[model samples]
Target: MVNSSEQAHTEIGPLYPTYEALRTAAQPVHPSSSARRLLWMLNGPLHSAITVLSSEITTHGVNMPSEPLYDPATDIWHPIAQEPVSTPKVSSVTVGVCQLEEWGFTWCDMHEGHADPPELEDEE
Candidate 1:
């Protein structure tokens, strides 16, 4: 008895949960942890600032960066560039998305164990 729109959303509901989860979770991890954990998992190296921040999160516990160096102009940290910066750890998922976007990475349902992001076929 579901409408087409409901059916469509239900069909797509399981995909792309990162944004939803991060958005709705009671306590989303700080951007520093999210960035460092993801980066370490992908590249095997922690952001220089995150090295200290991670230890503090492990020991003392914190949500914001221990030593933030953000730049209000760009709405991001200092040394803005394509590659992830070592200093000025990110503090929010929004900023983390910006960093990932810079690396050509986008939110994907596949990341949450669902199908990969859809790709369009080239017209022949």
Candidate 2:
């Protein structure tokens, strides 16, 4: 005979596997061949500067500019403040629950209640 807890877990379905699949799908794509070729063609100084900029962007996410502003004095184009880049908040349990819901799994809080799954911890 299956225990109540076991039955409950079964009803919740396979959450971890679904969460893993979703997380894998969410990974960033590599730069295309054309973009790589263009990077290769860039001059040494320009290439170095671009490489540094790319590294910084990768390390600390950049805020997308809403508008471009050109200053005649400095002869530089600057980005106006807009929406900031959002940090990633990965919760496997939450994602799994959402995925289950997407697959037509109905949750009853009154019976099962809210309990944090083992994989509820946020991933870096």
Q: What lDDT tens digits, residue by residue, belong to model 1 across residues 1-124?
A: 9999889889855333343355476534344333443212234333333322322244344353443334345566533233332222322223355666655444453265555547889999
Residue 45, model 1, lDDT: 31
lDDT of 1 at 2: 100
TM-score of 1: 0.18
For each candidate in turn, the TM-score is 0.18, 0.17
lDDT of each: 0.41, 0.37
Best by TM-score: 1
- lDDT by residue (tens digit), candidate 2, 1-124: 9999889889975423333454578854333322222212135443222211222222222342222233455765433112122223222323245666655334555435555545667879
Clashing pairs for model 1 are none
Each model's total of backbone clashes: 0, 0
Which is the leading candidate under lDDT? 1
What TM-score quantifies how close candidate 2 is to the native fold?
0.17
